[model samples]
Target: MSTSPTTLIAVPDSLDTGTPPAPAGRRWQPQATHWAALSIAGLLLSWWALTASGLIAPLFLPPPQAVLARFGELLAGSYMDATLPQHLLASLQRMLLALLAAVVVGIPLGIVIGVFPLARHLLDPVIEFYRPLPPLAYLPLIVIWFGIGEASKVLLIFLAILAPVLIATAHGVASVSPLRQQAALSLGASRWQLLRHVILPGALPEIITGVRIGLGAGWSTLVAAELIAATRGLGFMIQSAAQFLVTDVVVLGIIVIALVAFALELGLRRLQQRLTPWHGQPH
Candidate 1:
């Protein structure tokens, strides 16, 4: 068939190729934001209804409006002693520091151990012993080791965060296919060369996954650490508020932690997307 030149149209490479051929099957692509928004609305509505109906007392459950107002109050420096910014900074600093320490030490050790069966076998039992224990459960020992200052808090957070990173990194390394390793070997790649060029990149996405999850756990541990020995973190603020029956401040602190955690998760997701564009993307 002959086509006229005038009938032809140019399309950019970025343009969608329209509907792809079906594989005699179907899949659902759900938009997460809509569900998330609806969930928030439902929870708020339930809270409002329960409180307004007097079925839930204010002492036990404050209204959403009260919490929202308290959030604003916190931002405006209405709270005493420690300001909102100080608490946020303190928590963020601790979380970041501990997360860094965990990643720096854990990832290397995990990769090394995972790439070698003997190392894994030797260390697995020790790892299991430490991994199952809660950071709080080791509070006394950590205090004794590092004292009750920032070191203890950082150590506790690091312990809480370390296992996930190590586990994830090890799994990533172990999961590298034998085929890839064989191919690299056939290409005359040395042990160090294969590790540097093939294994690291393959394992990076999983390593990032570990880091993301570890950061979250580290943040949680930070709250616990602060609640116990902190003078300036959001957890300390919440603890103080609880003692004074200042539900508003307590709610504010909870919301702050939630907001920060949510923000960190979102940031990490964006980072993952940027780092691993191939992840969950169709060929």
Candidate 2:
């Protein structure tokens, strides 16, 4: 009587048990582009509102429209004996040249200092001392040495850029994983091979970061450098415009500088991601 044989049930692995599946990795999230656009739009609206309401004088902060009109005029004609394109190109050339020189000299020097304690000890003091000094603080000496020419402007920018790159490179090289070095050496890799394969790649992200920082510094210093007897540049254009009370041109110049710096930084960041895609990735 007691019991019919108890029935045994087996569950299949593929059978749905009514629970939802866990999300595949992480879900894709919203991007920052929309927010950036919104912020920019908001700023423009605020600027327009302020100027339209007569709360802010156009002399100090021109409406965006006025700056836009001035920008077009400059593009179509000339300012300070050079067109907008020429001024923009001149500034770009100086920044690029300075960046190139900084990269060429700084990366190698930083690597040396990072690799050799003796070298680091010898140069660290000098670098640290000069790194904290502002560009304007030493511009006079640079001008005296290089004179009021392209050399001075380029050199001023170069010096402004050098410290960040050098520090970043040295830090990157020094921060390389010792385990990677050991593994490479165990595989009969020479010092150069180890550096080429393991160290440089590992250090690339930091180096790129340094370059980005250096570019920003150099860009900010552009106006100051160009102020040193520059006849044609965005800095000079802005300065000259300000002297003549052409607030529209000054505002336009400032906006142009910001846009250009943003573009350069965006490009460099892309390059960094391309070169070091594995950066910050989990093992």
Candidate 3:
């Protein structure tokens, strides 16, 4: 039989869509640096406007310049008995110690709670009861139990950080995809191997997030922790400054705390990205 008459249709080599999908709306998106700078500038301008205009007394809300001067003074010489570096070092030492202890104890306990319902049921009530209590509320008990020394301060901060880390880790571990676990099992993975290769890796992002949150809680509790008869800490310095109505110094202390906490958060974020490089990546 004769084949159907040969027929062909022309096809364009490339569709050549008009505009590239990428770099369209994204190009107009605000850069983080620009937005951060703008926000800082706006806050400073508003602060200056309010204070310089005499709408708010300098005593209550000192001008940014005054706070800056106070910061310089603190950095150059002693604010109270302890110099800026001394106070900062003391605070950092306590925070680091507390954070280390929390991480060590919290991660394993979290894993246990996440992996076993019995553990969760047994421990969750105790964690829940204590987690909501303000650090200040328990400060007295901590001081009485641990004594009003470095132990009390560190212990209080540790407790403040522990609950969040534990909860985060448990949630993260529990949220690990069952498919991933099954895949690991199908590959002849032992329980320990599955935990090491699949479960831990999958839970890392959430654990890191929980650590971030825990750090925040720890910082907020720092002042209270230092309230335990501290002679050298940012908290003590600020408290003394406030008692004496040294608002400039108080403001400077606040700024220092903010800057330090911001640095910590940035550091943790970088660490998390390094550890979980696959996170947030497009397929």
Which candidate comes out best when scored by lDDT? 2
lDDT string for model 1 (1-283, tens) is 2232221444333246665433232334446998998899998899889988988777778888888877776675645566788888888898888988999999999998879999899988988998888777888887887777998888888988898899899999999778998999999999999999889877888988998888888877776787556888888888888998988778778888988988998998999899888766553
Total clashing pairs in model 1: 0
RMSD of every candidate to native, in Å, equals: 8.1, 8.9, 8.9
Global lDDT for candidate 1? 0.81
- Please provide, for model 2 over 35-119, each residue's C-alpha lDDT reduced to its tens digit, 9 standing for 90 to 100: 8888999999999999999988888888888998888888969998999999999999999999999999999998998899999
Model 2 ranges with Cα > 4 A deviation: 1-30
Error of 1 at 272 (Å): 1.6
Candidate 2 versus truth, CA RMSD in Å, comes to 8.9
TM-score of each: 0.84, 0.89, 0.88
lDDT of 3 by residue, 1-283 (tens): 2222222522232236544333223435567999999999999999989988999988899999998877777776998887888889999999999999999999999999999999999999999999999999988888778898899999999999999999999999999999989998999999999889999999999999999999999999999998889999989889999899989888888888888999999999999999999887752
Candidate 3, position 84, lDDT: 85
Native-vs-model 2 lDDT?
Answer: 0.90
In model 1, the clashing pairs are none
Distance from true position, residue 88, model 3, in Å?
1.3
lDDT of each: 0.81, 0.90, 0.89
